[model samples]
Target: MFFDRKELTNDQLVTFYRQILLPRMIEEKMLVLLRQGKISKWFSGIGQEAIAVGAALAMQEDEWLLPLHRNLGVFTSRKMPLHKLFLQWQGHPEGYSKGRERSFHFGSKAHHICGMISHLGPQLAIADGIALAHLLAGEEKASLVFTGEGGTSEGDFHEALNVAAVWNLPVIFVIENNGYGLSTPVEEQYRCSQLVDRAKGYGMEGVRIDGNNLLTVYDTIRGVREYCVREKKPYLIECMTFRMRGHEEASGTKYVPAQLFETWGRKDPVVLFENWLMSQAILDADGVERERQRIRATIEEELQLAGAAGPADFTFQDEIADVYAPASEITGEIPGSDRELRFIDAIKEALDEALQTHENLILMGQDIGAYGGAFKITDGLADKYGVARVRNTPLCESAILGAALGLSLEGYKAMVEMQFADFVSVGFNQIVNNLAKLHYRWGQSADVVVRLPTGAGVGAGPFHSQSNEAWFTHVPGLKVVYPSSPQDAKGLLLAAFADPNPVLFFEHKALYRSITGIVPDTAYQIPIGKARQVHQGNDISIITYGAGVHWALEFATAHMEIGLDIVDLRTLQPLDYDAIRQSVMRTGKVIVLHEDTLTGGFGGEIAAWIGEHCFEYLDAPVTRCAALDTPVPFNTTLETQFLPKARLREAIQRLVSY
Candidate 1:
């Protein structure tokens, strides 16, 4: 079928027809499966197939594709296996995501496709990161990101576009303005007359077109991709179309106006294309029928195979198994003999060594370049590596983390620093939802290390001083490490960079300058998931981490007559349960301590674990010592009183008496 033989060859025309037909057939089949309860949900690309297929066909094989949930045609156009799609919908083990995710929440590195998370706007920044990597490597490929009209309302969308424009990243943002976002119409979603007009604010080119016309969509995308590659700039295109079906199969079209559907039905893309093909004598009626039958047979076969596949063999342990780096992979030699070093100096040394060791390592944070970091941890790094490697970013925390995820996905390791751990709440979605679940959902490695300067003791108020390690410890896929000494700080930082997953490295603000110990100059990794017994005793065991380690040591020194064992847990998520059990079993009395608030601190988790597993071996109830359940005060006296030291001593005295 070739209506315009001069513009496109007969083969190209046939490919377009096949692309359109595949998604249409697949959409119909998915609806049938939904009715039969073979699939839990179905998102149709009925009237919107042209946008997805056209954009996919226009991009080069090396270019990346980040498609939204409704873009089924992108997968088909990328030559993704039909049976795998069925298996994914059926939640079978052999699927792309290995049955971990239910629907279109997976990506393929082999195919240059970035996966989509439920939070739509976050992917926009991630797409920018992919484009930034290509730009940095001198690659000609651009990244294509898809989103709906509703997603544009999110702050991430604006942040990504603005950064892409400022940096001139080669990214193409395609927004399918399908008239409605779920149930809300476009008029209610935005006050602007046209979404493309917003591009002027970011100093980027914007276009609006008829999304129903396959040829127009294909031409526009191809032109934009070439322009972006040549100019190293971002482009935005708003495709005007309608969602013929419901948001999902379960959400019917009752919310949509019947007259609007009736009006759009007359301009159906498939029907118009078929009529044009027949009019041009490129395809006869019999030829159209044959193509439809062939697609139907292919879908049926895949569906049957997918239906017969077994469920995934998943367990709770699998979700948390790979949180920390394996010990074998962390092996390395220490260069120089041990020398006394401050904790802050040790952290700086680790960064300096890591940057020199790994060529792909890049450092990113606010004021981290020539100005150094907020705490000078990354000072003089930009002077050594230049601004390209040690770059300073904006105040957008979410986009910064999202960009890190994108860079990690493209085979680069990123060492990102949050100015303070308290501000991490701004980027919580990217950390908890995107960074934590990437590997669990699709086996994607987010080799990113986030340095969170945490804890209180510095006269900084509620916004600057807060111990938030307990928040991350609760997440299954994150590796939480808080070091108490200079040696562990240096070693753990190195290990965290070597790890192939996201590691939340919590550096206590109070310990950074106040603590000093011998640290090796050479590269080395302290084994993760192992606790060190600083002192051994027969009376009671004190389990603690971060700055609490120093406090526990002080408490034990004063109470030598009571006899105490000090267990310093450097790693939190993949905790050293064996060490905890052995220490508690020997002492027969346990007390968990932390700097976080007492209500839901990590000490509760430690106490719960001990009570559940070591109840019979214990001589008394497990005691927890943590800060009072109140915001850290600005006054030094109140802050000291609010902490866990007095409470810890009281608990120790009570446990000894018991």
Candidate 2:
């Protein structure tokens, strides 16, 4: 629970009143515009202005804010220009997202605010990362994140609170209990007596407060901040308030009983604050009207300027633009030592070198610290860099990934290792929706490298053995790197760290110690979206990656008379189409092979592209070899048959014979 609030000065009281009044007036005017068909939509924080206004004013400007749909006061209280916010609201070019997104879905780094995704729970975990940055830098700053009462039910909410409590992050988790999550009542949302009580479960302090009282809000939050910065811990504040309007202006509030409004209406935050100011003789009725007029006139001027900026003109090409950072001019191979290292050791060497090279690098995952992770990839590195750099995380994959994105926002690069590639399913929302879309939607770089120990040779069963790269390759704004051999593994992992987007680095679980190759002693980079020719004969080409690369090379080596050309597609995304085309054109026949299942595999994509582009040159139909459409089996014999190992020879014979 928060400490007792000290009395506020007259100036502080007046400032709070004015800040609370500003959002109320702006929302009121926006309602008129909404009716008149100017603004498209609005999430009215009409009666609950004090929660946003008071919270924003109480926190330092240096602290970051993760705000949701209805918190209009956060933008205004931060002194973000009304005109630009209006442009953002109107989907114009001058806005933060440059009309790439609408509503409050854009963050302003200058104002120290990260916008919320529609999936509200993920932001809770992201706030942990922002607070982690403060902890890393030894700064007093904390991160404040808000979620509705309904959001507390999300898995990310639990993950976030648990992580924050475990790590002792300075995050002020504010839950705005506005009586409804859309149409569902609060009673249906939870069985707990109060949302703030959840803090006890996470081993943190919490307090419920009168959100309608502007003075209480300002003082309580100020005290909460002081306690957070001093104690270096998490605290929850449930602001007890009611929505004065529908969830959005488009959604009517008929579900809300009329009597309920009458009760909550009397406790209106703006009127409560205004009456307090008048009774104290700090302001009068005339002054109130004069202040409203002053704000109203300012709103009009800002609106005119915003409207004058006109709409954002975007073409189809513009939609594709800014989807990724400038493609790395860094291309070609990494020269290596004669010393042979296992695939896993090569990756470990790259990470160890990276920790020494960059100070802002952070490694987070389950058992990744002193325990050295599930596969020992992080072995002894935590001992060298300390657990601060090579950090261990909870079972909450979604929260950890969100935190990685947040850490990136704070000038830090984070590499999160999913113990198994299959576990990425638990955190897909953060990977695809949050990290993959952050830069294109808001121009914020999400420099995260997630090392996914992937593929299906370990007989780890259905849950553990998975080739999930195809799922991510379909998602734009992500770089998917899947390398084969010790050399490419070391080189590409370094390249993944350099690229300014979220990258999925897939490492085969079986290849860790089974295969060894020449690897560079120090750090190096291989160009992503490039391929290498493993075998030179041009009679027929086998396009492959990951475990498939080894499979194809062995088959080509054994069948010397077949005249096979094996092209290793080290990077799955931004596919080395030029290399693919070159192979297809030279051989006049091609086979796409992968460790994943046959249907909807990356093999299907390569085959489709070859058919579409190189049909004229292809002497035969482009063939594909992949595992059967079933879960990876537990038995080694069943798994071997389930994989493409047996199917590749048949695929090669067909393509070569044709």
lDDT of each: 0.87, 0.89
Please report the candidate that would top lDDT against the real structure.
2
Model 2, C-alpha of 287: deviation from truth (Å): 1.1
Candidate No. with top TM-score: 2
Task: In candidate 2, list every pair of residues with a backbone clash.
Answer: none
Q: What are the runs in model 2 whose C-alpha is more than 4 Å off?
A: 1-7, 331-333
RMSD of 1: 2.1
User: How do the predictions measure up, each by TM-score?
Assistant: 0.96, 0.97
TM-score of 1: 0.96
